[model samples]
Target chain A: MFRIIKKSLKIGVVTGQYQKGEPAAVPVVPEVKKKAGLFKRSFAIREVDTGSCNACEMEMNALMNPVYDAEQFGIHIAASPRHADALIVTGPVTVNMERALKDAHKQTPDPKLVIALGDCAIHCGMFKGCYAVTGPVERHIPVDVRIPGCPPRPADILEALSELRNGRP
Target chain B: MPEARLCDDVLKVAFPAIRQNAPVCAKSSHFVVPKDLLPAITHYLHTQPNFRGRLTLLWACDHRPVRDTYGLYYLFTLEGSHHWVMLSTELIGNDRLFPSITPHIHAAHWYEREIRDMFGLIPQGHPDLRRLVRHEHWPKGMHPLRKDFPWDRVLGRQQGEHHFRHIEGEGVFIVPVGPIHAGIIESGHFRFSVAGEPIMQLELRHFWKHRGVEKLFEQQTLIDALPLAERVSGDTTVGHGLAYCQAVETLLHLEVPRRATYLRTLFLELERLSNHLGDIGAMCNDTAYALAHAHCGRMKERIMQLNDRLTGSRFLRGAIRVGGVTRDIDNGRLTEIVEELNRIQLDFSEVGAIIFANASLTDRLETTGILHERTAWDHAVMGVVGRASGMDCDLRRDRPFAAYDALPVNVALYRYGDVRARLRVRGDEIHESIRLIRELRGKIPDGPIANEPSRSPDPGDWTLSAVEGWRGEILYMVMAGEGGRIHRCKVRDPSFVNWPAIQWAVLGNIIPDFPLINKSFNLSYAGNDL
Candidate 1:
């Protein structure tokens, strides 16, 4: 027990301070509104991987790590879609996952925002016209925000979330 | 090109009649055998005392307009001799049927099913001919890998449900798990049969996330397919990319410079390091040891950041190209890597010691999920799972590709075949990976990084490349078509073999230990589903 405490102390402020100061790596997210005042409270998000290579998932998971900690901003990865205020969908929607993606979106309460979180999610990226890929995430359900990259970095993800917290763009 | 001695011996033993007719080694090592002789040759080679060649790959290509029949290739790696023998046969006419090797080689079950689903080839005696990749909703008589099929065409889903095999008994109740999970993981379904606490049977339904990767590869040019290969499995970008490049290099006969080979080795080890740390942490997390998980997560993130510093992408995508790696690391960057690694090793070992000292954590991992040696061999498991089970095979040591031939790798092996053993293997491998990186630091050769191919590869040429990825052996067989196009590319992830064995691994363990056992193997759904 003493060792655990000692170890924690040595690690020393592992969590990030994204809210207090400018983040080190700020990816350019276009179309950020200055003052919409939509998101003033903490948000709970449920991540849905339609059919990713898992690169996006890794980056999203990294956001919860000590350096890029999203939890410090009161953003949490909810266990269930029912508990979430927004749905963050990744990858191009495969045929088998289309129904499930819609189901998760339906399960989340009304007024819940849907953020499509990769190039694949935005426009089916490289997987466009794949036989198994039905369409992009928006084609199946409505999307409020789209973050594009093969996989957006952890900072880019936080920036997008912070943008959403400030206003719906 | 000199013929390997084992290849000559295999020919002499399997086809004695062919020697009297004509010399089989005329068309290089790859021999085109008569369709009827395939089963006999396979059976003889498999049963022969001198030549116990393991069936490595079985795939089919649609040869329309040029030929009426679909051409099938079976590659076997003869053990102890490092000899690869390629045998091709054509399944003539519309009734494309080939004798199944599953009756003798049990591991051929999935490959045959894949061939059936992708190329519309019928395996005559396959026990389970149900859809492997394509689901029940897919239209009948539509094989997507054929050249005639368009890459973008999507037939609307037909009305049907995949009939999962169920256990019916008085007390055996079904516990169906996700196509979607409570966690932020990819989609895969697992049906468990439990009497009360103990699991009676496990039925799996993956391929939910199959985004027509193979078909997409067929659409890309030889060099353009590197990005697609990198995304084959996100965590294994380096492994898959290197394997694809190796095949392309071999096909075009382009030699990668010494400096590039060392750099490739560095990235591969880095990938292995990050993944192993993440998996070890995940395994602990499953047992509710959140502290160890957090520490490990921190370590993993550090490695990923290091990857980003070296290469542009965190996963090391776009770092590797068709001929060699795109990025080059000099001495100054190498010093930074060594210093960071030293710090990480100290931090990681301390965390590992803490986790080990905890009795509850160690007890939970000790004997929870045991996969016996006999069962592992029966399934022909690869990578860490196989090593944990005492199936002593590491492709780096056995096949020795890339700069691996220059240096010896001390493969971490254990006989326990339990969750603890798997964890131990990963821990040991982490240390070994760090050691490997340090050894590669000062010894890197000064030369050109890449060698551009002098000429485009001839049509109808093909080659196979295998890399011992962090998970296991990742194999890519690239076949060229007319006008420098890829005819067919078959990707066989280690998960393709390991996923089936999970059903057996969960036979006696309770439902609670499933996640722990699953994490120990840590099989990639994307790799298998693709």
Candidate 2:
């Protein structure tokens, strides 16, 4: 038990300092702005993976790690859709998950931003024209932001969410 | 010599009506049994001790344009050898009445059900021929795999409720969980029959994520199919991608360079390391031990970041191609990777000690979700689940493809078949994978990363390649089509065989421990659903 406390204190303050607007430390940000508005408030997101390879989901999980520490940025993946301010949907949206995707969108309270998290969510990605796929997530629900990549990195996801918090949408 | 004798004996003794015998690969053979003798052949192979016929794959293809009949293929492997015996038969002109082998081979139950749903081929006397992949609402008789059903045809979502079997008793209440889960995981429904806490029965319904992976493979050239194979299961990108590439390389008779083989092995071990670490953490978290879980997640991210640094993708996507790997790990980078992995191992050991040291954590893990040794063998479970249950099978060791043939792997085994045993297996494998990466780093020879195929794969040529993915045995069967394209590609992820084992494991366990036990097995929903 002594080792736990020692290790905890040894690696002190692992959370990122996002308040200083140090975007360069994180890799590859497509947008930069020295603005402060809705960034002051906490944001809750509910993740809905309609149909993905799960790679994007892995990155999303990484946001909870000590290095990323999404909680420091006032972003938490809430358990219920009613608590969420945004919905992060992944995959090309399979036929089986179309109804659930729509319901998740409908359940999220008003002023909810829908972000398409992967390439598949953006435009069906690699699963185009397959019988099981029901096309892109946008076809089922309106998406405010589209993060494109087979899977966007955790840092990129954080940057996008932070940008959302900044009231850029 | 004994392997060949076993294959020949099975054919000559049981399948005297065999019309043609062809070599599928160096270690595998294809036998075209007469349609009338298929049931006998399938039954005999499963019953015979010499054959030890473990049904690995079963699927059918519509040969209407050419042969005017549907061709059904069943591949099986013996207990010890790497040799595979493929039995195939033709059903004349949609007369899809083939005798079901499930009455004898319990493992072939899902495969037959899938065949009935996808190809509209009736497995005669299949006890429960319920729709497997099509779910509850897919229009009856509309088989998606047949040539008549266009790949892009959208059968707009049909509305219906899935019929789940419920126990009718006074105290037996049914608890239904998820086609959409609360956690950040894939969709799968579980119905548990609980009689005051202890689960009397559990039935799982998955395949909600089946996005026509096989159909997508049919649409791409072999060169472009690697990315789709990687996405078959997000976590097992290297395993599935390497298996697909190896199958293609075998069909084209192309020999990958030594350096490429070593690099592929490196990437595969890295993938394995990341997943095993993450699983260990998940299993701990399910038990409410958040400290170890968080640390392990951070370590996994370290490896994932390293992956991005090396191959531009966190999940090792696009790292492998048809002939070989896409990137090379130079001497400088290789040394650096070994050093970083060693440091990670040291940190992992520190965190692992805390996980195992806590008696409270170990108490919940021991004797929880126990899958018996006999049940594991009967179901033919693969990877860590099989290993934990004392089913001694690792494709990397048995069938030695890529660098595994040159570099021996120490297979982790246990007998308890409990949550702890599975956790112990994963823990041991993480160290084993790290050792393999370090050893391969030292011995990696300098050479070309890939070899250009001399010609396109010949039509009608078919081959099977098996890789021991982080989960279990991943098998790929690729057959060449007209104009040097892929005709049919069947992927059997390790989850395909292990998912059934979960049903057996979950019995008698309380409702609350279900998540912990399920995380212990940690079957891939995407891989299994696909």
Candidate 3:
């Protein structure tokens, strides 16, 4: 709707529901490289909201928007925990949400990567050190990365997912 | 504060409109009126008050047969600063059919609907008392809030696509939008009956996202209640948390230090400023006003930056406490806030000028969602939504608490009761908020931020606290337990009453504008879902 940018002969741009795009970043697989094993291109992500303000939900949805199109990065939010190679958890794991969080963490396939999205999940941020809350996600499930924001923008969420998918620091 | 004097010449002159109870001016936290007369009390409130007697607040209720007595708890904030009263009436849980005040107060119609869904208490005389915040698949006998209702009852009930019925008529088509859609706000369905571009009627079916927040809050201790409050609606985090903390504080009769109070007010306004900017942008975006909406988005991000600077978090998280606020302000921070508020006001003025002055924007918004002035008063609407439509109620100006008493609260009013007026009021409020922030900084007392009150709230003490937040008045009713845990906790977000009004407001508007109209009110899904 915004016509701010000058028109261009657009390349093959993707549009539609639940379609996967080319992977933006592929894993290095350093150890596999030493053994001469090829790195996998596809990534499976599991999304869980331990407890959130739902703003994180906003950014999560944003990732799938026409602009960012998280699927364009070959990262998909998987339904079953068993299929996920990485966990994208939001909110400050509250006492009530701990069991489910740990359960999901356990269910994820081995060689799992954890990305704690938003400040609430990383440091418990504003909700830190509360009686009802059990964590900043690290207290229950080990986190590979912490994306800070009351909620990070969609780009930030995508960045976290892509980083974890590639097994990057 | 006297029963005899409460009925002076002015009270006597306005007395007749309906049933009258000499308000038991009880020295308790918050205010109340008896429950049996809930219908009559709201009706009487409509007629008697001298000031804007339109707005009313309905909190949570305890609808259980305890010793053969069921109590319905609520708080009232009369339009204009006339009265703030709390009411509780005992009823037999099944005899819970209290007469609906909706027929009298248009707003009570929806509030009654929600209470029925959650508590299984019918609102007698309610025209359409169907569920407002629950799924259609939700069980008939399962009242989620009832202490006895187990958590499993809502598990499978939460999943599945909702069923919506269409009306068979010539040129009439039903557009069922959501239960689960693309965007990530929270799930709810809006079924619109449209003839061409114009909407014939709209029925909102929600509760897909109801996570049993209220049930969890009841089990939570006062210290542990913050997480639930934070998740009610992410956008208005600080605003609602402060309201909850104030309620618990009042129940214990604790005094928040002035410094703590000022900081709470500061954070509240900052949250308000950011939300309004974002909302104004979204409203423009809804109407295809891309330039104006994007400009506002830029301003909003700046406000978020200001939030990150002043408090370590952008959404102003965990800034409130029961006795006082959590964070402290430093000298350099005070200087930064003054500059940030000034810069925000400057950018805000430009967006306000462009939107209010533009013809295209007004053509889309003005009179599109016309919530009648009388209808607004009948619902006892609060905050900017009520104020814009001439339903004069703002808790800070009327019912003073925190730093609102020390500074000025310049309420913006518009008579048009249209989307444009709502837009105008929001811009005016931003200016006023900027002024309020300036004033608070100037007069802020330099001292230790908090004092831990000596006493905790006693068991069986039924106290309610209500504050005017960005959307409207948020009321919290607390019934303390033996230890630190809460026996019953009710958080009444204004959207519980206002969302249904949208059903009426959207009756005649075109289908395209419903989202825009709803955005102006901007009621929280999670707030009501709780």
**Local accuracy by lDDT, each model:** 0.83, 0.83, 0.67
TM-score of chain B of each: 0.94, 0.97, 0.89
lDDT, residue B7, model 2 = 70
TM-score to true structure, per model: 0.93, 0.94, 0.77
Tell me which of candidates 2 and 3 scores higher on lDDT: 2
Residue-level lDDT tens digits of model 1 in B278-367: 999899999999899899999998898788778978888888887777878888999899999999999998898899999999999998
List runs of model 3 lying over 4 Å from the truth. A1-52, A57-158, A164-169, B1-4, B7-41, B48-55, B59-68, B92-96, B150-168, B182-184
Full candidate order by DockQ, most accurate first:
1, 2, 3
| Candidate closer to the true structure by DockQ (higher is better), 1 or 2 | 1
Q: Isolated chain A: TM-score per model? A: 0.83, 0.82, 0.73
* Segments of candidate 2 deviating more than 4 angstroms: A9-13, A16-40, A167-169, B157-159
Q: Model 3: DockQ against the native? A: 0.12
Q: What is the CA-based DockQ of model 1?
A: 0.63
**Residue clash pairs of candidate 2:** none
**DockQ for candidate 2, C-alpha atoms:** 0.56
User: What overall lDDT, based on C-alpha atoms, would model 1 receive against the true structure?
Assistant: 0.83
